[model samples]
Target: MELKTLSEIDIISASTSKINQVDFENLTFGNVFTDHMLVCDFENGAWQKPVIKPYEPFMIDPSAKVFHYGQAIFEGMKAYKDTHDDVWLFRPDENFHRFNKSASRMAMPEVPEDVFMGGLHKLLEIEKNWVKKGKGNTLYIRPFMIATGHGVIAAPSSEYRFMIILSPARAYYSGEVKVIIAEHFSRAANGGIGAAKAAGNYSAQFYPTKLANEKGFQQIIWTDDATHTKLEEAGTMNVFFRINDTLFTAPTSERILDGVTRKSVIELAKRENINVEVRSVLVDELIAAAKDGSLKEIFGAGTAAVINPIVGFSYKDTYYELPKIENSMALEIKEKLTNIQYKLAEDTFGWTVKI
Candidate 1:
C-alpha cells in the first residue's frame, strides 16, 4: 500500500474543549482522553488517507473480524511534558517497528510511517495541552488496529482500522507489589503470538491473574508454557531479578515481550558497571537465592509503570519476601528513565523524540 503524505491527512477539529473538567492531580489511568484522535481505514487493497478528528465513537458491524476472531494488535507508549512545556516521546520508533512486526504475525497490513508517526505528531500537536508537566504524569498513547470487515468467517478480515488515542494517566501502582509464580496457567505457548502486543495475549491472562489476586497476590510471574519452571515475565512488564548485585532477566523470544524499558535498564546498568544477564531465569535459582539471602530485588519494567518493584513473590506453597534494602536499583532506574523522559537530565542515549 502506498503511503499518504502529511498534506493528505484530513482534519476535523472538536467543537469544544474539555480541559477544564479534568483534575490533573487525580486522574484515573487511561480513563480520560484528549479532545481528538487519529483514525485510518484500510480497504480496497490499500490504506486510505489518515484522519484526525474529535474524540467520538463510531459504529462497526457486529460481524467485524476483531469482534469474532480477535484480529487486533496494539502498542503502548507515553508522551511527557517538561517543566518548559516541551513534549517528548520515548523511543517511538521502537513502538512503530514493533507494531508492524505484530501486524505481520497477525496477517494484517502494515501501517505506513506517515500514518503512524505522522498522525501521532499531528494529533499531539492538536492536544499538546493534555500532556501534564510533572513527575509521574504523562499522556498515555495507545495505537491499535482492529479487523473491521463486515463478514467474520473465522478468518482474517479484508478490512482493518488503525487508530491512535491519547489518555491522561498518573503514576501507576502506588505501593509495593506482591506476585505469584505461575506454575499452571500459561500466557503464551511455543510458536504463538505471545511476543506480539495482540489484545488476546493480555485478555488470556485475566482469569489467571484474577485467581492470583484471590490468593492475595497483585500479579503473576508467568513462566515457560511447556515447563513452567523458567520465569518469563510479570503482568504487563518484563520481569527482572537482582541476586547479589547481578541483574537477571529472561531473553525475549516468541513468548516474551521485548520491552523498551527493560532494554534501557540493562544498558543503564552496564553504564554503571553493573552486571546484567540476558538469559532464561529459572524459578529454582530464584528460590535458592532467596534461601541464601541473595535475592535482593525484583521489579517489572514497561512503558506504563516505568518501574514497578516487587516486594514479595510466592512459589509452590511458600512465599518469599524481598529485603528492604537501601538505595534500590529499581528506584534509581525509574528516576533515570523518568528524568530522561521529562527532559530533566541529559538524554545520553538519544531515546527521546521531541514533538
Candidate 2:
C-alpha cells in the first residue's frame, strides 16, 4: 500500500502540556525533552505526511539497517524566546541543507522541505510555552533520520524514519575548556563521512576522548588522518587559532565538518577588518606559536556552545597555559552572536528567523 501524500497532511497534536512539571532551573542540556515531536516515514520511494504527536518511543526490529549498517544522521539547532515574547531560530536553512547533504552521503533519502520545516514550525508553535525567556534558556532542536527496515543485509534499507525532538537547554559547557592534541588516534579520513554529521562520526571519538578526559582535558583537537600532524577540529566543534592578530583555522575537507558558527565567526571577523586565514593549521606551528607567546587564543565554535575558549592545551604529555586576555576574539565574537541570537541587538546578517 502507498503512504499518504503531503497534500492530505493534518498534523496530530499532543493532548497535554508538560511545561509545569519541567525544572527550568536544572536543565542538563539534551537530557530533558519537550512534550511533542514530529515524525514522518519514508517508504515505497515516497515520504509520507509528517505527524506532530506526543513524544514517545517507537519500536524497530533488531536487524534494522540503522542497527547493522549505521545509516543514521542528525542535526542540532536551537529556537530562542526573546524578552518580547517572540520565538526565533538561528540559521535553520543552513541546518536543513546540511541534513540533506548528510543523508545523501549516508545513502538515505532526503527529507522533504515541507516535512522538515513545516512540521518544525507547527510543533514549535504549539510548544512555544516551553521556550523560556531568559539569558541562557532556549529550545534545543534535534532532527535525525534512521533506516528502519528489518533485515541483516549490509545494503541500505528501503524504509526510513525521520524525527524531530525538542529539549530545553542552557549553556552546554559552563567553564573554560582544556584540550589535548590527538597524536595517536584519528577522528576522520580524507574520503570519510566526517563532513556529513553522520551518527557514527561521533562514536568513533569516544575512546580517545575518554582517555583525554582522564588526563584532565575536557576535549581533543583531532588532526588530519593522513599524518595526525595538522589540526582539524576540537572535539565536537570547529577550532580556531589566533596568532598575534591574525585568526587561523583549518579549511573544511572531507575530514572536517563545515560548522555554521565557524563560518559566521569568520564573516564577523572579516567585517571587523580582522585577517582570517583558512588553511591547514599544523600542530608544530601551533606549538611554536605557543612557545613564543604569539598564540593569543584558541577556541571552538559550533551551534551548541556558540564559542568555547580553550584555557590551556596538552601536547606530548606537556601542558601549556594560555593567558586570559580581556580582549580575546572568541569573547568578542560570542557576545555579538549571542546578542543577535537573543534579540538584544540588530541582526545585521539576517540570521534569525522568527516563528
Candidate 3:
C-alpha cells in the first residue's frame, strides 16, 4: 500500500439516489444511514488509497477474520451545526487518538492521523447536507476498523479495513434510565480488552443485558471483577454519581473505556467550579449515600446520548431511587458541552473543530 497525497485519491462524489424514506422527525439510533461513506484499506504494512463513494454493501470473504474472531473496533461521534450554519466536532482529536488505541488492542493496523482526519473531512464535505441544523440534530459518525483477511487461523489478520459511515440522528432520550448493578456478570476483567471499543466487548454483553432488559432495566452498571464492590461503567457509557452537589466518577482504568465525553464532562465540571472526585467509587458507598439522601443524582456520559441521567438502580434485589431536581448537574454539564459543540458558547477549551 503506497501512500498517496490527499489530492491524489479518486474521491467520487457519487451518492445513492434513493435514501431511507423514513421521517427524520422520529428516527432510531444507527437504524438509518447517509448516502456516502469513507473507506480505506490497509495492506503491505501501510494504509492504501482512501475514497468517498455511495453507501452500498460489499462482499466479504466467508473466512474473513473479523467474522469468526470479532476483530473489529469502532468510535462514535457527532457533528453539530450552529445557528450560523457552521459545522463543528467536539474534541475530534481525542476520538482519533482513542481509535488507534482500540486498533492496537484488537491487533489491527493503526490509521494515520493525517489519513483519518483527511478522510473524515472529505467525507463530511460530500455529506454535509445530511447533517441537520438544530439544537439536538446532528450527523452521527461511526469510524470502524475490521480485520478483512480471509483466514481461519484464529490469529490476527494481515489486512484490515477502516471505514466511516454517517447517520442522521435525532435527540437521543433514554428518559431517566433505570440500571441494574451487576454482582455476577462482569463486562470486562483486569488486563483485558475492556478499555478498548472492540466489537466483542459489546457483543459479549448482549446476553447479560438481555437478562437485565427482561427485568425491566435499560442497562447494566458493571462492577469490578475481583470484588464487585467498586463501580466501573455501564454497557456503553461511563457512570457518574452526584452526591450533595459534588460530582464523582470512576477514573478510567483497564476495566473502563476512556470515553471522550467523559473526559470533557470532567473538564466542564471543573470549569464551572463544581467539585469533582475522580477516584474509585464504591457501590456500597453510593447505596449508603442514597439511603441518607446524599445521593443527589446519577448519570451516564457518552457521545450517543451526550448525558443520560440514571433515575435509579438495583443491586442484589435491592432498589435505590434518586431524587429529581429542577436543575441537575447532569443537565447543566450536558447543555454546556453541547453548547460548545454547536458553537453557541465560548470554546475556552478549544474542543470544537470547524469544517
Candidate 4:
C-alpha cells in the first residue's frame, strides 16, 4: 500500500452543531460524541482515500467477517486542551505503532501513518471545541478497524473500515475499587492474542468480570492462564503492586498488553527516585506480603483512568485491605502525569505533542 498525503482526504462539514445541546459540566464517559468523524476504507490490498464527515451510523452487511471471525482491533487515546486553547496528544506515536502491531496480530491490514495520525489531526482541528480545558476533562479518542468483507466463513476479511471518533469524557471511575483475584478464569494463554488490542480479547473478559461484579467486586486481577498464580492484569489494564516501597509489575509478554500509561508510570517513578521492578509478583508472594505489613498499594494503569488505586483485593475468599497512607505514590504519580498531560507542569520527557 502506498502512503498518501493528508490533502487527499475528503472533508464534509456537518449541517448543524450539537455542541449547544451537550452539558459539558456533567458527562458520562464515552456516551457523547463530537460532530465529525474520520473514516477510511481498505480494499484491493490497499487503503483508499480517507474521509472526514459528520458522525453518524453507516450500514454494514449482516454477514460481515467481523461478525463471524472477529477481525477487529482498536486503540484508546485522548486529546487534551491546554490553558492556551491548544489541543495536545500524549504519546500518540506509541499508540500508532501499537495499533499496527495489533492489526498484524489480528491478520488485518496496517493503516498508513497519514491515514491514522493525519486524519486524527484534521479531525481534531475541526472538533477543537469538544476538548474541554481542565484537569480530568478530555476528548476520548477511539480509533478502530473492523472486517467489512461480507461473508460467514471463518477467515480473515478482504475489506476493512478504519475510523476515529471523539467523545467528551470525565473520570472513568469515581469510588474506591475492590478486586478479586482470578483462580479459574483466564484472560489469555500462551501464543494467544492477549497482547493485541483485538476486540475479542476484551469481549472474552466480560463474563468473568460480570461474575466478579456480582460478588461485590469492581474488577478482577487476572493471573497467568497456565497456573493462575502470577498476577498479570487488573480488569482491562496493566496492574502494579507496591510492596514496602518497591513497585513491582509483570513484564509484558504474550499474555499482557503493553500499556503506554504503564510504561510512563514506570519511567516517572524512576525519575522521582522511586524503586520500580519489572517482574511478575506471584499470588502467594502477594498474599504473604499482604499478611505482613509489606503490601502497601495496588493500582491499575491505562489510558482511561490513568491510575486507579485499589482499596483492597480478595483472594481465596480472604480480603486484604491496603492501609491508608497520607502521601501515596500512586496519587503523586497520577498528579504529575495528569499535570504533564494538561500542560500544567513541564513535560521533561518530551511526551506531549501539540496539535
Candidate 5:
C-alpha cells in the first residue's frame, strides 16, 4: 500500500488553548486531553486524507457497527520530554505495528504507516507543550480505531475512523496494589481475541475486575482460560513473577498480549544480569514458591504503569503476602528504563526516537 505523506494531511487549529486552565500536577490518567487530535477515516475500500483538528466530540450513528458488533481497537503510548525541552517517543513503531495487528485480527482495515506515524508526528509537534519536562509527567498517546458504518449487522463495518488523542498523565497506579488470582473467570480463551487490543476484551473483564475491586483488590491476576492453572496476565498488562532469583513471565500467545514494556523489561533484566525465563508459571508452582519463601516479587509491566509492583496476591480461599525487600529488581529495572526514556542515561538499545 502506498503511504500518504505528511503534506497530504490537513491541519485545523483549535480556536483556543486549554493548557492555561489544565492543572498538570493534579492531572489524572487518560482524563484530561490536549487541545488537538489527529483523525483519519477509512471509506470506500481506501483510507481518506488524514486531518489534525480540535479535540472535540463528533457524531456517530447509534447503529454504528462499533455499538453492536464492537469492532474497535486501540493502542496506549506516551511521549516524554527531556531536560532540553525536546519531545521523544519510546518505541512508537512497536505500537503502530501492534495497532495494525489488532486491526487485522478484528477484520478491520490496516492503517498505513504514513497515516499512523506521519499523522502522529505532526499531531505531537503541534501539542509539544503538553509533554511536560519531568520524570513522572508525560503525555499519554491513545491511538484508536472504531467501526463507524451505520449498521447493526454482525459483519465487519465497511467504514472506520482512526484517531489519536493526547492526555497529560502523572501515574497510572498509586499506592501498593493487591490482586486476586482468578480461578473461575477467564480473561481469554485459547484462540480468542485476547492477544489483540480489542475493546471487547477489556469490556469483558470489567465485571470480574469490579468484583475483585469490591473485595479490596485493585486488580486480578488472570489465569489461563481452560484450566486456570497458569498465570497469564495481570489486569490490562503483561505480568511477571520473580521466584527466588529468576524472573518468569508467560510467553505471548493467542491468550496473552505481547506487550512492549514486557519485552523491554525482559531485555533490561538480562542486561542487568537478572535471570530471566520466558515461560508460564503454573498456579500450583507459584503457590508452592510462595509457601517456600521463593516468591520474592510480582510486577505488572505496560505503557501506563511501566512496572507496577504487586504487594500481594489472593488465590482461592487464602491470601498470600509477599515480604518487603530492599534493592528490588522491579524498581531497579524501572529506574534504568525511565532514565533511558527521559534521556538521563544513554539509550544503548535505541528505543527512544526524537520527535
Candidate 6:
C-alpha cells in the first residue's frame, strides 16, 4: 500500500462541470451531487493514495463482502458558505470522532483524522461552488466506508473503500412532523451499534418507519429495547421534550447516539438558564404532563435539520398536541446555533471550524 501525506495532494484546476441538470431551489434533500468527489482505499493494513475524481460510479464485485455481510458505516454532515463566501463546517471534529466510533463498532479500521480532514478540505475547495450562499442552502457531505474485498465469507474483509460525496442541497423541510410514541418496535438495544451511525442500524428502521408512515405519521420516537418504556431517540435525530419550561432529554448511553447538535443544545440551554434534564423520559409521565397541561414542546436535534419541532404525537391510540408559544426554546436555540454555523454571530463555544 502507498501512503501519501496531506501536503502531497495536488490542487487540480478544473471547470465547473454540469450533469443531470436539476433546479437548485426546488431540490429535495440529498438528491443532487456536485462535480467532484474524494476517494481513498485501504488494503494490506494501510490506507493507500487518495484521489479526487469526477462524480461517477465505479465497478465492484457482485460478491463483495459488503454486499453479503453488510460491513458499512456512514455519517451525515453539512458545509456552509457565509455571505463573504467563506466555507465553514460546524463541529467537524465532533463528526470525525463519531465517524471513528462508528468504524470501531462495525469492525472497520479507524481512519486517520488528518486524512479525513485533509481529504475534506481538498474536496470542498474543488467543489466550492456547490456550497450556495444563503441561510438554507448548503453542501451536504456524506462520508462513508464499505468493505470492498471480493469474497462472501462471514468475516471481516481485508480491503475497504472510503469515499466522500457532496450534494448541493436546500434546507430539509420536515414541517411539524407527527410522530408515534414507540410501543412495539425498538431502534437499538443495550450493547448494540445504536450509538453509532452504522449502516445496518438505518436499514433496520425502514420497515418500522414505513409502517408508521402508513399510519399517517412522519416518524417514530423509538423507545428502549429491553422494556420499551423509556424514550430513546427518533429515526435519525435525538429527541428532546419540554414540560412546563424545563427541557428533558435522554442521556446518551451505549444505546443512544451521542449527537453533536444534541450536546450543543444542552450546553446552550443550561447557559440560557433553561432547566435541562438528562434523564430517561417515560411515556406515562409525559402523557400525564400533557393531561395536566404542562407539556409545552418536543423536538429533535440533529445536523440535518438543526431542530425539528414535533407538533403532536400518539401513544397507545391516544393523541397529544402541543400549543405553539411565542418564545419557543426550540426556535431560540436553533437560531443561535445556525447563526454560529453561518458565521453570523459570535462562536463563544468555539464550535465553528473553517475550511
The TM-scores, one per candidate, come to 0.98, 0.96, 0.96, 0.98, 0.98, 0.96
Clashing pairs in 4: none
For candidate 4, the 10 contiguous residues with the lowest summed lDDT are 1-10
Q: lDDT tens digits, residues 146-207, model 6? A: 99998878999989998899987876654569899989988887888889888888889899
- Candidate 3 TM-score over all chains jointly: 0.96
- The order of the candidates by TM-score, greatest first, is 5, 4, 1, 2, 3, 6
Model 2 per-residue lDDT tens digits across residues 216-328: 88899999877888999975899999999999999998989999999999988998898999998899998999999999999999988879999999999999999779799
Q: Which stretches of candidate 3 lie over 4 Å from their true place?
A: 1-5, 19-22
Q: In candidate 1, what are the lDDT values of residues 1-355, reduced to their tens digit? A: 2222376799999999999999999887789999999999999989999999999999999889899899999999999999999899999988999999999999999999989988998899899999988898899999999999978478789999999999999977766689999999999989999889999999999999999989889889999989999999985999999999899999999999899899999998888888999988899999999999999999999988899999999999699999999979998888888899999999899899888
User: Could you tell me which residue pairs clash in candidate 3?
Assistant: none
Candidate 5, lDDT over the whole model = 0.93
Better of 2 and 6 by TM-score: 2
TM-score, cand. 4 vs. native: 0.98
Q: What is each predicted model's overall lDDT from 0 to 1?
A: 0.91, 0.89, 0.87, 0.93, 0.93, 0.86
Query: How displaced is residue 312 in candidate 4, in Å?
Result: 0.5
Per-residue CA lDDT of candidate 5, range 139-199, in tens?
9999999999987679999999999999999989888899999999988988889999999
Selected candidate, larger TM-score, 3 vs 6: 3
Q: TM-score of predicted model 2?
A: 0.96
Q: Name the better of 3 and 5 by lDDT.
A: 5
